[model samples]
Target: MIFRSLADIEALERTPCEQAIAARTTYGLIERAARLHGARDAFVYLPDGELDTAPQRITYAELLANVNRAANLFRSLGVGPDDSVAILAPNIPSTQYALWGAQVAGRACPINFMLQPEHVAGLLDAANAKVVVAFGEHAQLDVAGAVRRIPGIEQRQVLWVSAPGAPTPALSQRANEAVFEQALAAQPDSLQFDPRLSPERIASLFHTGGTTGAPKLVQHTHGNEAHTSWFAHMFYGFDENTVEINGFPLFHVAGAFVYGLAMLAIGATQVLPTVLGMRDAAFLRNYWKFCEREKVGALACVPTILAGLCNQPVDADIASVKVAYTGGSPLPTELADRFEKATGIPVRNILGMTECSGLVSIEPLHAPRVPGSAGLRMPYSEVKIREDGVVALRGPHVSPGYTDAARNAGMFEDGWLVSGDLGRIDAQGYLHVTGRAKDVIIRGSHNIDPQLVEDAFLAHPGVAMCAVVAEPDAHSGEVAMAFVTLKPGASIAGDALLAEVAPRVYERPAIPRRVVVIDTLPVTAIGKVYKPALRLRAIEIKLQELFASQADGREIVVTAKERGSAAVADVRIAGAEDPALAARLQAALGAIAVPVAFSFS
Candidate 1:
């Protein structure tokens, strides 16, 4: 069905989802696809992410068989329905086998390999991982070294995987360690045991939020995953003939479920870039050529990628490309418009969360781009804006809750998942996300949304990316501060740029007090702007400005660090300790939001 609007989605919902979709589990969905399109190409892996390199293709039948073999192998290693299998690898064909195979046998936990060793260990311990499938030694990432650093990794079953034709790294002999290819080859090409798969069974455990404190492992039931994949497939009008470029890492929800499983469930071919994925410079430089060669129908990317693609010349034929899907962060209107004008491809925004199995709403490919809207909710799903403007959702696609029930307090209310995003449901059933509730800056009694300030700056042609964060204030609790990255060859002073964009911001209090220009903005692994680092930088700037007058041939050094949940700033004065100066600095900083610690050396 081609979903043009919310009405189209509602029309399809008249028939219950259970009646509409025969497959109730991810395994069932894949099995059904294999039966229908067994000979079709399921995945096309680019070995070196080069257009000239010959790609390795896997058929649906081979994919299902490998999944079955991996499941059987896991069962032999003592994995039960309740146990979890952890996979630490990039986007690879074998990673897909381990992910689905683990789900068939038990639950799968795909860990972010970019995380620190301690954080990775914490996630493994939290998920109670029985088996770990890690990528072998490579030039870029030290997967083996990170796995070895895990406290009790030696006791767990470890299977190593390498890219096609890549040499497998040798590891110290351990009773529990084995090469994944050799182990998987020994297993039969069919299921050895009945999984007794059910809709309510946990399919995977996905980690969300920052990896600083306790890890938040979101539990996705088979029903949650199956519904989301099916809804996305139907919404985007994907079929066996669709070929898409999927460069997102396996650990992210967008890669694992939204764009990954959704395409596989329909037997659509997914072209995976090299282990570096979109980060590979050579691949990005020749992205259009790859698309033309592959005849890609759907383009998967984030906002940052769109901005980069805007700079890349359209050096090849891209008439086959129909749509570009972008999420992981708010889509800047300027970037979207520029991309569409450059490549003539419509950019659809997606609103998703780990708790929702990767989807809440997606702009249908059949629908025109809405300026600020995140598009309509999934068919048969419920999305309502709270009185306070926070978006709430409830449906089969929504996860039950995190593994740690305590973490679900503010997020989950009864059956509705309280999305922390501040948004409004338009009269047309469109969701327009304004900003995050926690991202709001408070100045005295007035509350300001950072997006307003960011939008104002982004309206300028010189600004490439902008992030507005809360800066500590003496009188008011906090104020807005903006950090921006200029376009290539664009040069403008911070004060002049701020003056040019300040008029665009309607709210006076929402205007940023200071503007900082940098070569690039801090972003997460998936390309979303990281605001925590910006907030810390703002705090340091405010403190440095406050204490600049006290420097009498004494170097004043300011550093900020997150202590538990609060941000603490340390100020070091280079000289003999002066009680008066310290007292003044402490009093001045105490009035600010972040706590300040004074040290003289």
Candidate 2:
């Protein structure tokens, strides 16, 4: 249903004609910002190694100049309209220049600098990049290694961008690649905006998944990014005085579009907290101090960092912080309450994906903070809750499609993108994200919802945090296995939690078969629980239980594979000369309703 816009008010008034004119091109943003706030601080980066020194500052004029030079460099390299330039870098300042400049020259493809070489290589191949801009050795990125993953990708095409202290990439000289700074030296600092260039031209490509399978490259145009950045900039009431602290990796969609580019849109100062930006302990510890010292007005963080921050003692008066926005996962009501109580800034829950220019909905600055909700939809976006409670998005900010056409099929149905996230809209119009629809655990005929299971455990006195995922089984499909972190000091053993939490789920198969207590649950860079690791651990735990005592001389590994709605297990016990041992293992697995096949080494 169309959200009633009659009562919905926009903080910044924009006539239809004016909105159309402003979003003409990616260069229009930099041009506008330079004109409006040239002398204002555009980006401020705080180094993690040494906090005693003044934070690095870049004025809007300087940022624009750098962007123009970068665009010129790309042009010199023969990159033109619609061509893709792949950048493998972290959250550093040059990453921004690479982002906008490459887009101005061609299309910018930002890789998750943390992804495996093979995955990154696959993405590079999909994006069809003609050139690679890689950060130097100090960023800890294996730039050459990743490039090596792609066959026939000549090293000469790579432009190694070195940081202040970073050494030249090991392979740069041998391949005759130009240094980024030196490459721009001969290029002119000013670039003329192409009058013929349409704003709808593809500006960037961001990688999204491996959620269902291999990651797909989502296409974002100039207009798509412009609309999203402008929406957030105007919505937040950002200006020359607004100093926002951003720790999200610039390679991520949320990081580049919402946190990074949005700042440039308004000419607001962005504080890059650290290289180890997200959920970094050192940064979180000094958050309040940095806020008070730097006059940081706004900041964005994931729910996991917020949870950890809530646990820290708030000793400083952080009156300078105007707001704190959270996304990337559901913000637990309890966590939100604790954070607000400790720090006066409201933690507005938001939900977004890589496909939609990185924002679906956020709690507007003008409105009262809605607890436990992802807040209202952006004015440009049309959101519909599907019959099955799955959230769907369609708007100007929505991506045109993926780079890989094979992966594009069924991605969008009936004009609305299946967000893959399950959620609902309340009567008041606030959206509540439940969980990922694919993360459901299938046990026999019953669907074991992970969010439902995890939420129940979150209420337990001993549990600090919890994640539920399906572990492959020999029989009855997949069963729920919970990995939990207990509250500090008030603890009980992991096995005891099974008995305590079992009563919450009356259905036999729904109850988690195992509760593995952990010092901390594995989390993604964005702070959501990493379920894939837990699934692997589940298989490992089952294998260990069967063979830890039985096989002391050799290694035994068990794997779970899906077979339609049910699953089958492959058990390999090394040097299984004894047929009776296989029988014992099979019988044990069978007792748990599992069908397992054993192979001897």
Candidate 3:
């Protein structure tokens, strides 16, 4: 959809539509433009065929009409301002309509469909949503079971959408209640609402994938989100002519706020591809072809998604793409280099969270390459390196605490959002994120952080992905264990990984003493590896079995002893001795305590 402000591009002479533009906010731009260019194309999508062949274009007039009708429907159904309406769907055209319609009347919450039932229940309850719009087959929407288990949804209404003639879910549809598609089809296509919006009106609430504790509901206001969306547009340099393709799930703030709304705020053409398995080779091939055919200008991807596309050689017409933004988790340096080299598009790193409306810092295209940075702070953001070493920020885009008090307690400090990410800003202003502070592991008086070890593994070509965990160790307090996933058709032994990381981490006792091969590491909905789960599994594994059998009850310990005026403590355990380990341990803990005694059990 092209806004009137952007339509003057093709006209040589003074165009009637070309007028100075000013809007209170991003939504204002969308809502106000319907009056002048009500019949102009607002969004174009295609379920099949090339971009030029029979694409569906919904005009601004039609969009406003349908939005008003849906808002009226919501009002008639008792959905007033402050009421919550949640949507569970992909980036289908309807998803936008549902969200915008709800925004016109009340708050809109978009839940991730990939979440399990309990997770969905938590969000539903947190949102206090009076209505939930979901697909017919959504397993998380078992209305009967949900009512029984979650008290918050007892009298809540459920709306189901199914294919045209298909039977709907038994609970909500047996009585012929409100069906999604039918509701939209029945409503007249246009409406308008008064605009006296504020930054405090909650527009959406998203829950992050908490690694250390329970996920907290992040509350964002209209002003907060509009500013974030505008900032993204400014930083990404998107214009009305930009054709942006979004395959990312519309749940996370980054995906929805940064990429999705930013596209709309710029009046750019946003493409929603068919919902297909990200790993399906045919889907990847076809999607790439679609990008080339449509001449997609901007796109965002996570590392794993990019890695999948890179596995096979593709000589498609990706040369049109100008910017490839990537984040959510650290992208492997090798993967970033390969993607940029192959596509001729620079991959800009971004750092953000659900609490901050998706983006905080973006590594500009002109910035020099830094190994593991999430880029520098964005234009409107103010970041501080707190004394405790955690990154904190305060900005218009920052959300207030979650609704739940207990969950809010640890998330904020003074007035700033205490971002859980651990990072430092260099004198040159480049930020290098090391790892989560809580994930830091200390073994035998030696501190071993997971990110350092993971970076080491990423340097190996055969190692497609890797995770490091702290396994419980009675001798050294804990031992660093590495889990490696090799590239497809590539085989690398555990010994090879140990050998590779051994030299890099030799000076520190945080080096992995054992390595194991796994097909893949468990990842969350947003593509972050589950390190807590990996640590739990690592503790259960017995590394001694991989080596030759030692005496079943064998054990040894070396104690601390004094050297000159300084006392040094030493501790070592051996099932099968390799003098190299002892030397490493002694060097790791030089001045801790004197060596006391040695015992064999």
Whole-structure CA lDDT of model 2: 0.74
Give the alpha-carbon lDDT of every model.
0.89, 0.74, 0.64
Model 3 RMSD vs true structure: 9.6
Task: Please say which candidate is ahead in TM-score: 1 or 3.
Answer: 1
- lDDT per residue for candidate 3 within 220-321, as digits (tens), equals 787677766765664566776778767666677755777777766656666665432243344465666767877888877777666665664666787778
lDDT of 1 by residue, 310-421 (tens): 8889999999998999988788787788889889998999989999999989988887889887888988889988999899999998898999998889999989999899
Models sorted by TM-score, best on top: 1, 2, 3
Evaluated at residue 524, the lDDT of candidate 2 is 69
The window of 10 residues in a row where model 3 has the poorest summed lDDT is: 1-10
Q: Which has the greatest lDDT? A: 1
TM-score of 3: 0.79
Better by lDDT, candidate 2 or 1: 1
Model 2 per-residue lDDT tens digits across residues 197-311: 4657898898876332367789888887887777675456566688888888766776887877778887788888655665456677777778878888887888667767767
Best-first order by lDDT: 1, 2, 3
Q: Candidate 3's error at 411, in angstroms?
A: 1.3
Could you estimate the TM-score for every candidate?
0.97, 0.88, 0.79
Report the alpha-carbon TM-score of model 1 versus the true structure: 0.97
